[model samples]
Target: MTHIRPTAAPATRLALAGAVALLAAACTSTDSGGAKGTSTEAKGAVPAVSAPPSIATAADKALPIDPYLLSYEQRDQLERADSVLVTRCMARFGIQYQAPPQIPGGNRPRSRTDRRYLEMTADSAQAYGYHGAEGDRPTPAPPPPQVSDATRLVLTGSAAANAKSGQGGQDYNGAKVPKGGCLGEAKEKLGANPSNNGGGDAQLARDIDAGARERSKTDDRVLGVFKSWSDCMRTKGYDYPDPVKVLDDPRWSSPAPTDVERGTAVADVACKQQANVVGVWFAVEAAYESQLIEQNTTALAQIRKENEDRLRAAAQALSS
Candidate 1:
């Protein structure tokens, strides 16, 4: 699957990885056409459950696409397993390497949609304002272990990492560097390396899922909600085109939330409630995702299977 980073605003950036693909070796299997689901939803026809009731926020509601997606935990596990594989490959070249930390030292794991959408709760808006975090930030992870010029080439499999790194040629310590270096070899083992024409048809499902999100932004239903939200905000002296505009407001950039930021956030949540912005927006996206899922059930099934395969392999790699 293709792993596109979330396009959410910084404040909305949390634990969700959306449709992150798995790392695997059998992803290169041929496409078997598309899969089918029981959903026979006709064109322009949204499924039942148009929208959640008032007070039912995204935090408690999983979208139609959630079942077909990789949770943040699954993505993290696959990545750590990939790192372990890479570390082993590095050992073959006589280089000591440490895998980078995947999860934070102390924090609850975030869900796929914990903060996928904008914060719509009155409490959160009032507490942290546009800054989703509270208290001092966690210490940043340490820098990656430094390697020698020759080691860099073996690690990255990139001749362009530096001039001296490449001059050592493919043969280092009498062992040839894998086609793409250790990283490349690790991906090759998982069959998830796209550059080499690897990967399964599950990418089709991922593309559709990501496409729904991008297209939803311009959807007329969502656009209508944006206007209502904007008008409601104006009544409170917060003149902004839409909620997204506030994400870029230069006034919110600081070490902490200022009084002005808190006030704006409080008003923002109020406007959202007044306009039912979250309710409408969530339903629209759900409809789009539902249609896509119904249209591509076969491919989605393959993705789910491939992910399970990756987890098993990753678990084995971690144990070894």
Candidate 2:
């Protein structure tokens, strides 16, 4: 349950090339139903999607306890540990490395169960249209404190080193940069390397996410709701086949939403509400995730244990 402190600039952001692109396409709206000051709870009989006892029970089960999904807290702790190691190593080279300041009040954290489309509430739709309120959110801490040229040389290793066949590619003070550079050394010390599939945890996390997205696209229940939503949009003169398609519309690319985009977004939310898209989609995905979790219990347990050990080491590094 250790919270991983986020870095001023997360290197993981760079590592997750494709996954980050996928996330961008799946961007959630700021106005989750609760945040919009509106209620989505049904006052009477639940829709077929919410009425099934098995689905209801599954939905109630705590989500994202699976092996692959690292809780925000765990991710933050791991990042903090990495930063601590990096700072310590830099200091040995006489480089003053200041860790980035934490956000005053952290931005709302996304849960593993939370879906991008589901976050669009009627209230949010009415207010911001399809343009997400990302600009309104608190900015992340500034990039890590500036380093002098000597420090940068040590941290990045030398391009000149690659060229030099001998002398071990000397860095400042003729020191050989450790294999993989300073960042690699920090990761080695922490026993955290997402790029290496032999570790399995990072690769598994990516697999689970990719699997869910794929399943969602083909899930009968989800597709059914999407059809209803699409039909509703047709009545309103919009031609999007699904929510994802609607998000991809070029009109939404502007810094601020255009009237057309806003109007379409509002209608989109209305259709989603009318069709109970979020409720149905969530239940179906929950079932899928539960099955995946059951199939990978042992692998997940090992990942969880490794995470714990990493955090403990990170704590020690920070304290020291």
Candidate 3:
């Protein structure tokens, strides 16, 4: 098994598109679950949406993973060896590889059986050519853009929302309202808050506050996700191979591109092995974000505006 480095994906265009996507989605969803009685805040107006309580109290809400960490080091390593690093990475993430499973109980098969099993699996992979690991061999390029069927599977497969909804399909766990298009009924009927001044449900408020603090610590978690993916690849022998040294490696522009891409890629490889894990990760983040934004839309809006500028710069940097 050989390691392949991943190319850096261009960041600016990617960020710009994401920002625009969020903005566009916000404007269109009438049921964004904002102040229902009040007239929706005019988009250009100081967005009337209230900031979450956590954002105003000098508490930090954890940001999601940035996703642009890899620099094509993994892809280069695998490509040069004429092995399918992506497939191997996918295998680490849990895609079915034709290789024999580690059977316990010393169920050692006869040599003939083992060879027959290996040959069958190898033929299946060769026929499919996931992520073009086999395509690098002397074959005409299957298609331009060269995205593999596995990659596509990772993309269109269960999105991040499916697993987050608990008993009810609409909510992220009935803890907060769905921010995006998520909707479902609740499993447990929620109770009303008790009065304060030694009269209210102090425990409930404390629980909510604690969750806010935990969710705010997103940077480390996001980094861990990247490290986890990289480590998984390494375990499968895609050990961060340097793309620069690999002959004719594609010029990727960023580590993982962005949080969305990183999540999608993780889902692609991981979900194949562990379905709904990606959706769960996304749903947790989304639900936390909803709570945080409910208290601090102003700050988030400001960051979002700056994000547009940063994305433009990133795109320009990549283009240059």
Candidate 4:
């Protein structure tokens, strides 16, 4: 996502801060729906969710991550986090899993997790009165795999036949295929069935599932940051404060930007320059912190402790 620096007028600086505070607060609201449910009090009290350690320190040090070689526990932790996030998001947004609408990129059917996140996003849009006429939330999952059961069976049968005939797995056909057997044939079948080549059909599905898992984990982290930012910003005070008031501000766009874009923008404005440093820093920090708190149901302290312990163990291993 691309980050765009916000340009608010000098006169509206306080207004902007107030607006952000309102946003920070709404992010914390636990009520079922609209105006009555909205309150600033929810901002500081982060739900008791936890987060994994950051992939690397803020210093940009490369953490020792090998996609192909993650430890079982590490992978399990990621899967658990993914499941939790997908389930929560679907519930929050009220997304119907039976028939998810198509999204750009591809037509992958919505997964359970995708539906959940979409539901959450929909509710958020509705809460802000930005509901789409279609009334359907964005599909949280990637495009449904273009391949069908028929396609799979057909390909599998063909491959099996070819393997038996010695005609399968033979190189130099009109189509290009690597020289290998059953596993290789499986890869080829995936590629030919949907004509899906990118990650090699089944390979792609695994990759997407893995990606979803990783993203789920990050969502928790972002939520944790949100809670901390809300708490920190609450201390800064604003006149005529109301969490819903930000919704009234012209600049206050609900779903204020994609999380990543907002995070980058906040970091850019806060960490890169001294101009409007305090407010900018606060905004950026608040973006991450607000996300963490609002989305993360775990306690920040606990998340940090677990991550820190893991980091310590890794350091010990390196030393040993």
Candidate 5:
């Protein structure tokens, strides 16, 4: 994964959009739990809706592997730390860099898995349909400020370089662009191994996050719940064989949610609760992650430590 370097700013907050974008983007954009580009605070206000019908809501909470990875807030800290370092580095070359502002909590998902299985609760479904959860959607990002070629070179080592790359060292303005450019240098300083892009363990944590979810889809236990949930959907008059099929339906494939789409989405959540699809599926994947953790305790322990240490450094960097 060659990343786009962040001279512009660190990770902008992301939110999920409504049916129009999600009808097209959900399948692809949801892999990593809904990362996005603009601020988490959307331009408009969210209308209130009735609380979702109560059931086993544990799946809406954290999973076993969650403790090993960075929280949304910690991720925010990493972004702040990266931006701070890059801003400091750019100052040396007389380029003005504005670090991204700190993101307040509750504006972002508490966990990346908050919508992983997409068993969106009824409250959210009633409000946004299949678009996304309460605060889901990638807010549209503004155009990045334009910079000259020389500034670009210093900001990012290559034309498409990201802060995670450690190569592309060069000299400019009587000073060397630290082993990587300012962005990459920032990455290296913040504990990510720019050479490998994730310090090795971080990527593994990501693998665990995505891999376990993908693996759970095929697990027999999940398949069983899918059947139960599917049966429940049929009773509601929807003929979907499974929840996945509902998401893949051509009917909901529109920019705007139809009365039909919202109705179907509501029924989807109702069926999910009636069948406890999210609870069963979440438990199954959590068990899978537990096995993975047992198998990779050494690496996971290291990842946990690195995350804590990195956050500490990030906090110090920001406070200073």
Candidate 6:
């Protein structure tokens, strides 16, 4: 999934952080398409639940697209701007700050989406089975140079002081730490508010996500592919209702997948390939998103304008 760092806005920074984490989770395959599981039938038929198309349609109309839900290039520019700001902030205190090295490839979605719902590639399934690469991914870059207590007090204001004082610290060096400290200042300098278009964007994301999952539950195209996958799993002695059930199986909850889990995962991928589950689901989701985007052209255009403005501000901030 795309990783947009949260802004340090006083009212919504924490909420945005939580939302980003949730968005990450949403784009991953960890939650069985982000739907709760139901008991499987002995015959492997999934129960159907009808969804309203209006859910997707309404969500798109109600909220503006977030300017910060940026593409990889935009995110890179923002990160650079952030690094520059951090370096300047630290320099003010006579501290040299070396920005953390960027991850070699940087973070970009491998596909149109994060492939969370449909992540099992033929090779991935054969090699690692159902286990995700979360454990195997590269460690994060080391942090920048550590700051001294005095400098921390200057940057963070009272929060750091209160942590040391056993009292609420709201000010630093006799001044309140801006909402998120120096980091917040950096974000503000770039003209980015981490809040979701004043919270509307966040709600829109939730609505769209929920709508997509609901569609997955009942979409005829998805169900047809799922039936084929279920039949294939049954041949392998697994009686799963759908791909979601395959991951949601309690037996796969161990630190490492049980042998059965691994085997089942391999079989699951084979069946998904045979049934073309990923292709069908991807097309369906793209269609839904296209409709949403089409319905919100004005709002999305406004968001684009805002993003352009912020990028311009970031450029000025860096040059200055």
Instruction: Score residue 278 of candidate 5 by CA lDDT.
Output: 68
Lowest lDDT sum, 10 consecutive residues, model 5, at: 6-15
lDDT comparing candidate 4 with the true structure: 0.29
Q: What are the per-residue Cα lDDT tens digits for candidate 6 across 1-320? A: 11333222211112222323433333211111222221111112332223423220121221122232554466567677777886787566555665664452322233224443444555655555555444343334554456676665545443354442222234544544455555556666766544333212323343444444444445687789889989988998989888766654666546554667668767877787777776665555544544444544454455456667777876776678
Candidate 1's C-alpha lDDT?
0.61
Off by over 4 Å in 4: 1-66, 69-224, 236-320
Q: Candidate 3: deviation at residue 266, Å?
A: 11
Q: For all the candidates, what are their Cα RMSDs to the real structure?
A: 6.9, 11.0, 24.7, 19.3, 10.7, 11.2
Ranking, TM-score, top scorer first: 5, 1, 2, 6, 3, 4
Per-candidate clashes come to 7, 6, 41, 31, 10, 4
True-vs-predicted CA distance for residue 113, candidate 5, Å: 3.0
| Alpha-carbon TM-score of each model against the true structure | 0.72, 0.67, 0.21, 0.20, 0.73, 0.63
Error of 6 at 25 (Å): 9.5
Best by TM-score: 5
Q: How close is candidate 2 to the true structure, as a TM-score?
A: 0.67
Indicate the worst ten consecutive residues by lDDT in candidate 3. 183-192
Q: Total clashes, candidate 5?
A: 10
Q: Candidate 3: RMSD over Cα atoms?
A: 24.7
Write model 2 residue lDDT over 50-91, tens digit each, in one string: 452222112233445344555555666666777777677767
* Stretch of 10 with least lDDT, candidate 6: 35-44
Model 6: residue 109 alpha-carbon error in angstroms: 4.6
- What is each predicted model's overall lDDT from 0 to 1? 0.61, 0.54, 0.27, 0.29, 0.60, 0.50
lDDT of 3 by residue, 1-320 (tens): 12222222232222222222332232111211232321111222122222222211111222221111111222222122212222333344344433122111111112211211011122322332122122222212222233344333332232343343223212222333322111111001011112111111222222232343244223343234445545554554443322111112232233323433333333335312222222223334435534534544443343344334433433442343
Q: Which candidate leads in lDDT?
A: 1
User: How many Å off is the CA of 40 in candidate 5?
Assistant: 32
Error of 3 at 35 (Å): 13
